[model samples]
Target chain A: MISVSKLLCGLAAAGDGLRYDDPSGPDQITEQRQRKPVVVWNTTKGCNLYCEHCYAGAETEPATGELSTAEGKRLINELAAFGVPVVLFSGGEPLVRDDVTELVGHAADRGIRPVLSTNGTLLTRERARDLRDAGLAYAGVSVDGLPETNDAFRGEEGAFDAAVDGIEACLDAGLKTGLRYTVTERTVDDMPGVIDLLHDVGVDRFCFYHLDYGGRGAAVQDADLTPAARRRVVRRLCDLTREYHADGAEIETLLVGNYADAAFLVEYAREELGATAARRVYEYLRRNGGDPAGERVADIDYRGDVHLTQFWQGYALSNVRDRPFGRIWTDTANPLLSRLRTREDHLSGKCADCCYRDVCRGGSPLRALAVHGDPFAPDPQCYLTDAERQRDVPPADGNGVSEPAD
Target chain B: MADMRERTRVERSSGDGREWETFVRQDPDSSLRHVGSVTAGSEGVAYEQAATLFGDAADIWLCPAEDMCRYAERPLCDRIEDAADA
Candidate 1:
């Protein structure tokens, strides 16, 4: 239940859009973005495959990014200097960095756990073992569907098999392995099969994403994700999670689709866990879940990582003197997130007057800006976008009891 | 024994080809057999205690010695392998 204080805060938020967009609004942007953050360090811009659906298509290679061992050390030193507890290192392929093992060791020395996201094509048993030895905590592999389906999307013949092998290798090595499945128009048809594959591969958990219409797939928007498809996908994923829980596997169900379910889950989880813990889970999802650009830190592809916006640029943050990757909570000054965050969100046309405002946050700043050209604007697909009372959702059962729903 | 806090019964024929019906409760790691005998490992439950109730499936094969041990020793919940098969 919302406290009168928070309710008042909600009222305050209603005025924030007005204040923030005002020419006379105080210079609060920097203050808003100055909070402590989890940062990504791009180690390499080199990759091996050329996936058609990849947002980082042309940028996943060494030429796009480069940082010598010394340069890599400098970035780590800077994060440590700022007392940053976690640093995500990504690249064209972090595993390609010759000093990745060393970088992992350095991160371990600094008491930072390195987690990563990769296609898993280069994640051989030996490499996984080596990375584990080097103190890489976990690695997420990208596998869309079963072999026939997955291999096609990955644009590699043996990618599915390699990913399977990578998961087994990581499990055997006693390292955590997660599967990343990007949803696209082609992949939505096989949601059940995709869920089954997540089990068959025996991954510890899986992260789901509907096809992001950016970079490589941007031009293919018609063939990309449909809002209806995303809802269907999240519903199935929610059920799959229920089954996994019944079977006794630890499952964290995530919806990287239209923000509808994600928004609801956040409110529900918050009511169930209360405030502080809920905030942590939300931040954890943003940082540990896939970054918009999928920029990995030193762990996944140790070579060099790129920003979510720089994926197709094919370059490295290490190549430059200062790291260029965006911070999750500290992007107010960031041109991309700033431009996206300022405008009226697509859902704002509806969310501004609704109780679900805090939960949905006017839908994703990234996605709404992608479609409607304004992050602060109301989401076009939002049921509330049309001002229908039928579209508003109850906050939750204020008793803080969550009846499990599959 | 299944270590589950709750469970739904699912009956299937075992490779041993025994037409025995069993209800087991299990957790993520283990299960407790509450019916027809499958594996006969000594799970430390007493036997003769249920001898009177063994009248129907008492073909020794239907009610293995260990099954009695489990039923006899374990109350409602216990941690033992295949205790549910009991």
Candidate 2:
């Protein structure tokens, strides 16, 4: 996930752009970017609402072999011991689990920053307080669109009300709260309304997700936005983010499941805000290391199977119940794992030649593999123009001197 | 688990060398605690970096590291270090 608000407003306001690492002051050690991956634990496959494009293919009933509370706690210990930075509790609805609060407390007590990702139907006022008391750092509630649309998407009549209320509950309970919105062609027209709703609800952050073809999402892959439509929405998000930042609204904006947005943001800035501004944006994006799925992000399903990313359903790296997460993550003997660590050499098609490949890393491997059989194939969703994809000529530097292509 | 605040303390040198300190409050009524710091060239970037790095907070405030003031004798790390050094 790239924080559009953070990348643009954070650096743009500071008048500084290139630093990538955590700042070390006098007497502080320069922090090395650790290989520790942010782990998302899918607590259960049980969900109350069934959305059309549910990525987890969640059912109303819990899946078999879902981690026991004891198993879940043990995994938290293993992750903590492994130096995992964040453990996001995700599920068909994480709140559906009875031990979720206990698990959140366990993670926080172990110094793992605990976050919750849920459909929000189950997050009641008291439940929100319970979670906060359990030391959850943040709660991300999925709100797909307006009341009617969101309800239809969630496949429940009052899901929108329940979700919006859940967001309110989290906020009222003093927990840091944000909205997670997945955009499809159907809901694309409602993007601006969604932003307005975010403001109205006083959400602290908004994560706009590009559709990923996983689980039930595969069924709706045709509903995924066109490259042009995706670009239009991104441009709108950038404009809205800048407007909100300029007005000093306290909100964070981000795009998930896609890194092309980052590249497009830089390109957009170059055309609208001039070269200096574009360079600043480019430097921030570069530092963020776009599309850090298999490398920096990983997922442990309810059954303790570790996958390359949360969206990837198959190809388990190792089961946390069988081995420590740290060991499994560091074991590069798995050919795919090894390739993911340094995939630059393996990226094919326009991705291998595009100047912005470093910024996008061939976009989502899961998406690529879904559209084409090859995980390393060029991302079909890349919105860059033919000229941009060709890499025949170097992008013009402000000074007009072209450096040799790598 | 290692202290994330301590773990996240490393700095970057690629762009602007300026650094900012991040403070977060878990609740509207809670006092702010020093969460972590981010290295950015500008104040706007610092604030955004602080938010991204510490998004769990209900409220976040960022100031250039150079602008922050502290009592050298009354450091929280000293207490933490005493246990470590003991």
Candidate 3:
């Protein structure tokens, strides 16, 4: 049901996109569905931080750049005009640009809600207040996991505290805030600890994103979670959800994985969830990774070109300035972001048969095509022998636990 | 929340008009059309001149007839196939 709603909004936005597969019907009529009120606009092509699994694109070195204030403002203005009620700000670090507040403030003034996606190390109380005063509504801090796990994935010391501080600052400013972790082979083990940290910081609503590789991480994808590794992570996440829930805490976990178990888990996830819970679930799937091409997390090659949300060194977006990836959204020929809309894997190569294909967003078509030479191929780990599976603690599912509702 | 389409926005250019003259990428594969100014004639002649120019480009099969005028004005005109025969 959660997946269906997301598909509805996405498909409705496609405007008659469903007709592509329904050959027997009229050629150009789109069924009316709920429209997606928000869109993520990647303003900066470069990032300042270079974590092990970074996806910001072109973080090969300590480079710092952003979409010029001029064009950035243009984007915000256009988004407001397009009637996209919400715009998300992301980058190597959106704060790195001196003019980020300018765009965020502008969007907010125009009655367009603005959300900031940041690694969270650079945010200070003063900065947070400024953001709030400028009308920033929410902030998403990426803290991955606890110290040991987080440092490895974030590739920076003290990022843990920086992220916490960033969240605290936003909270201080009365902005609704949240945290997210890209569950991977390395950090999935620390799911329980990560949840505890979220509670400590007063975040009742948090999102967990399964690790995926598209642009930058494609360079180092083998380090990506194998299926066996992913199962281990999922089981633990499941247990943690149970542990927290049994204790009478209200905890919600948005699972983002290969969807290897998604078909079965969808009903399980909604056993007794609400609208907020449902929305949390939808966002988990919406923002998670996988490229248009099958590029693994470790297969990222920054020097190469890949279509990114923004024009990064790699990750191309066809025509960044004029078209919104017409090829990817050109009716229904695309199998990447618009996959959920068409309900078929037009470009997933051979992945359509896998039950998880529908759930995992086919991971990333570019990544799969890059690492496995077939976007439709099951994640390389899925086909391995059972003997290859691990006999350790399962991954955290976040549903087993519940934090006391604040 | 209000509907997403209530706001209106205009894309802004960063530089002078000369910037476009220097930056407009002539996609080598674009269709050619004729939109350039046509010669002024009698009272009803203005629209007729423009219409005639439009007709010249419209006769082409695959080429973008609207673009024919731009190329025709440049030194590249010699290279443009008028399709007058085709």
- Using DockQ as the measure, which candidate wins? 3
Q: DockQ of each candidate's interface versus the true one?
A: 0.00, 0.01, 0.02
What's model 1's interface RMSD, roughly to a tenth of an angstrom? 32.7
Off by over 4 Å in 2: A15-34, A390-406, B1-86
What TM-score does the first chain of candidate 3 have? Answer: 0.68
- Residues A218-241, model 1: lDDT tens digits: 555676655565555555665566
Error of 2 at A309 (Å): 0.5
Docking class of 2: incorrect
lDDT of 2 by residue, B1-86 (tens): 86444221212122114656566786798888654345567778766645543444688787665565433332212222224211
lDDT of 3 at A386: 37
- Per-residue alpha-carbon lDDT of candidate 2 for residues A1-406, written as tens digits (9 for 90 to 100): 7667766666644434544342211001122423677788889889999989987778888877687777677777778878877888998889889999999998898888888898888888999999999998888889888888888888999998888888889999998888889999888788788878767887868888999887788799898999999988898888888898888784778788898887887776666665655666677666566677777788988877677788875445645644567777888654466776788888888788788877788898878877876777887778888765554222344632222322
lDDT of 3 by residue, B1-86 (tens): 86554322222222101111001112346454222122122324434423322222333222221232221111111211322311
Q: How close is candidate 1 to the true structure, as a TM-score?
A: 0.60
lDDT of each: 0.47, 0.73, 0.47
Q: Give the least accurate 10-residue stretch of model 2 chain A, judged by summed lDDT.
A: A22-31
Which portions of model 3 miss their true places by more than 4 Å? A1-38, A45-48, A58-65, A267-315, A323-350, A354-361, A379-406, B1-86
In terms of lDDT, the poorest run of 10 residues in model 3 chain A is A296-305
Binned by DockQ into CAPRI classes (incorrect, acceptable, medium, high), candidate 3 is: incorrect
